[model samples]
Target: MTLAPTRIEATPERAPDMRLYESLVARVSRPARYSGGELHSVTKAWDAHEVRVALAYPDLYDLGMANLGLMILYDIVNRRDDALAERVFSPWTDLEALLREHGEPLRSLETRHAVRDFDVLGVTLQYEACYTNVLNLLDLGGIAVRTADRAPEDTIVIAGGSGALSPEPLAPFIDAFVLGEGEEVMREVVDVVRAWKRDREAGGLPRIELHRRLAGVPGVYVPSVYAVDYHEDGRVREVRPLDGAAPGRVTRRVVESLEPPLTKPIVPFMEVVHDRATIEIQRGCTQGCRFCQAGMIYRPTRERSVDEVVRAAGELLDNTGYDELSLMSLSTTDHREIVPMVNALMDAYGDRGLKISIPSTRVDSFSVEVADAVARGKKHTLTLAPEAGSQRLRNTINKLVSEENILTAAENAFSNGWTSVKMYFMVGQPTETDFDVEEIVRVASAVKQIGRQHIGGRARVRVSTSNFIPKAHTPYQWVGQADPATLRRRHQILREGCRRAGVQFTWEEPEKSLLEAVLSRGDRRVAEVIESAWRGGAKFDSWSEHHDWSVWQASFEEHGVDPAFYAYRTRDLWETLPWAHIHGGTEPSYLRGEWMKTLNEEITLDCKRDPCNVCGMQTLDGDCRHKIAELVQMKVDGDSTQKERLMQERERLMMLPVISAP
Candidate 1:
């Protein structure tokens, strides 16, 4: 039975008084963030679009404005004639207090529409620390904080990102989660909501009806219909669906190719974290880094052709009038035609004083050469990720970079006129020892010595270490994170050693790492603790000035929850995890095998060059057939000589480093 579409009466919402808003903005810091009339921002008529979406990033505008994922979705939604998307972000403490005092609700940037009037409120969960801000933003927007309290006419809340893999912790708040990449799935979501709104207006359907319908959509996980059973030991025994509409396991959505790049992104009024025109040159990485969640989830490596990237770069620069452009990817230097692509970009735009940068790259001399080609003599600080201290630890984590690779890369950078080098490492990884921890300092000191050879007293080396957190959907998911005391001890070692060696050093806050672990690996029961924390004024936990550990501790105590149970407990091999049902291409068995390999310090080869390692994508959609064929054709076309030479050189330059413990 085909039902005719019904036009629902839009809710009446009062726009904020410009005079009052202007007065309030004048008093706050960075008022330009709220005064939004940026270039290229679309503000469609309110009555024209059938569906309105408020895309929010639960952080300050400075950082959220630079998020490529949010921008991509914004461009996608606004391109549709029947729909329009607006932007919102978590207000700073000063602004939040002011809004509360004035009884003003959070408003969208484009049209100043009250967020409550939108049909759907989509929040991107980029990191776990932003969880409290999600609740605060909803409350400040005049929406119910909990999904269960929302009425039929209230805006439906949905979330997506890498953090959506473990949806249990946020199940009570978010109505639905879009697992994996949201490029294609977002449109389907809009269609579903459009239809549900029509049906609800026609017959006054209940809120659960909308959830039931959304559950049928591919890649959407409606948490209310799912029930989790816990074991006697507080571990998750199973997560079964109550409604037949819900799938037993929600497989991640994958797009065959990355097309329709956002060429005309909105230029922010204020400076953002990354204030440059950017193009995603590719998606996914094939390097099997055991401790890396992004490497595990975003599999089967897809690339944008060199022509497409170059074309996109030109369009982006022209549209935004920005002097700099960035080719973004998980591994920017790993692109097959990176050399020719960089050369093409330099040839075309280098004369225009356009600066190009690659954010993420491998630790090798080849990466140095690519940087050199892009920079063309304007040398700056180069960032590299060694990940671990010693070669043995690197092997265990499948970093695949040797000691020679590190020294040679630094040497090449120094020789190429670069003045400073920044290295990133991780502490408290599985099987980490005191000797391994001290090696990080040794490596940094060695790089400083090498740098002095070229630019004495002018060369600088900085080492930044982050406490390792075991994330969901990775090989380290079952491993226990080191306690705060142990991590602090390791930090002390790094601090004293770097001080003695005349090297700059910094480290992440251990408590923040603990909170990240608890939230990332937590289950549904932890939702109570989250709410409690928010009630006790816990927002912006990512910022050190705003994060109050005592508040989190009080909330945990009030809710009768132990943070250590989630952060520092190693699960048995046969145990079911909180996110077992949220499958992201890789199977649990494959991850388990990888974990076993990590224990034995075994290395898994990258499937991009070698044969398939069977990382559980074979039985699923969007496997690595195209990537494999491309690599094979490159070899057949005689492009493997350079790769062979690099491999042989790595073998010849292999040497042990002599160093004393700090």
Candidate 2:
């Protein structure tokens, strides 16, 4: 796979004058964002590398540098002597306008080379909302927006991330989709491309041959190799492989262990979304929240050793000079050795003015202890996701936390000098009710009362709710989302109820959530809708100010597709889904059984805390590699089936229409 000498540069040109680039910088806003003179950034002579890869994040500079996945790939690809990896991101609107006015193309921060000049252009598709941005970046790069229209000399466009799980929505725009983790697969992809590039340079093969070779890589989905068939109902009948290609099933990759720390994380000059070093304490969750795609997709919870985590944290802090570090996982408190880990972090870094944040923590008393230790001098606002208002509602979703535990946890947080606590809930869950919406307010009020009792009148209690979107590969994949009107009404009820109860409430706009739901549950047909929306002047839909719901609605209408069918209709278990062919480790039967249990208000126990119910994780390979049950004793916190039924009833009730006020 080594690059041939003829492919390498025969001679080096003198460095370009800084004055020319500086003059161009003066014409663009945030010129420094594109400059690649960062302290630790890797730069090699253009003639030295056979293949150049431009790894781009479709966001601003500060945020792009903070993404751990981007950094991991950046490090891995650059480790290859034959390939040079650079970075780029979407400029902010102001800068974008300036660049457009000047007719400037999207350029990499390292080499100042246009993205179109790279041998491969890799985009990280972290979220659905970033779809339009991806298109806009492609347009700026002077590349064809559709994968089918591009030639061999054009950069090979590839995408990966959480959004890759359901790549159909953006399939037409990207050349290939890398499912699951990219750590192992990305290096393999680079090697394949480098070999193909060498053969092309030697006049041994054509560019189409290169693509065909890449299409053969495991976990790579080249839409060109598959033909999508649709039913008269506009649903996808099948996504079949063509011309002796393999089936369209791409298995996700999982690293066997978390050793060999990703120490050289990119450091940014400006503030970013998550401006801190992150240590992935664990991957995946066992909570079995039916509506959560992350819990289902990243299964069989894998944990890094507590000692390794602590060592990584210290090294990252020293290397990056970040004041804050985040312990990332689905549930931080659920880690068996979390107490000792927090204690060790506090013992080591407490006096150094370092702040450690646990992004996701369960609603339990022990979480309060972990928070107290890490947030000693910080103005801590503890966040707990009860996911629903009532215990009955929680059980249906398999959120086993009881109302009493939430209250107790709130009290513990307030007692530990935390003045504010944020509780998260989701509207439009599979079996929600008006009473459940009201119960959200009731629970917030109860927690507020508890907070007042412990931390006095100055304490603040906030209830935050996000509209639920049905996602692929989860038990609720067969369920539909709530209509916009239903979501709006539910939001109003929660808002008014929280106001009356003297609790602060924050909620995401129903329209954005509705679109998210549509995209999340959509099939290959959505590729047209996304393309239409992008052509209709849609970009950065994730940002409230930039999002135009009418554009998406018009797109659906123009395509003669009803968003409701995807967003609001319950799917039959027998109905074929767009992503059914892509096995995400968990068996469909396991998810179907869980869905049936939700209907009966029957709750499944967490494999971490109970005997293995043979939910197919074992069938996939072996038992959970984390040895979850052995590490944490299974305890029945409360009644299971009764609670499940109550949750299901509440969910059902929330979806029912409420009579207008008299």
Worst 10 residues of 2 by lDDT: 1-10
TM-score of each: 0.93, 0.90
Q: Model 1: how far is 285 from its true place, Å?
A: 0.9
Error of 2 at 189 (Å): 0.4
Give one digit per residue, the lDDT tens place, for model 2 in 62-92: 6677688888888888888888888889877
Model 1: per-residue Cα lDDT over 1-662, one tens digit each: 12222122254232545466567767999988877668777777777889999999999999999899998998889889889888999888888889899998888877778789899999999999999999999999889989999999999999999989988989999999999889899999999989988999999999999999989998899999999999988999999999999999998888878876798788887898889989888899878889889999988788888888888777777778888998899999999999999998888777888899899979999999998988888998989999998988987888888888899999999988999999999999999998998999999999999999989999999998999999998999999999989998999999999998888999998889999999999999999999999999999999989999999999999988999999999988778999988888888898998898777776766777555667777655455665445556666776666456545543443422221111
lDDT of 2: 0.78
Q: How far is 217's C-alpha from truth in model 2 (Å)?
A: 1.7
- Candidate 2: stretches off by over 4 Å: 1-31, 203-208, 619-662
Candidate maximizing TM-score: 1
Residue-level error in angstroms, candidate 2, position 41: 2.0
Candidate 1: misplaced stretches above 4 Å? 1-19, 623-662
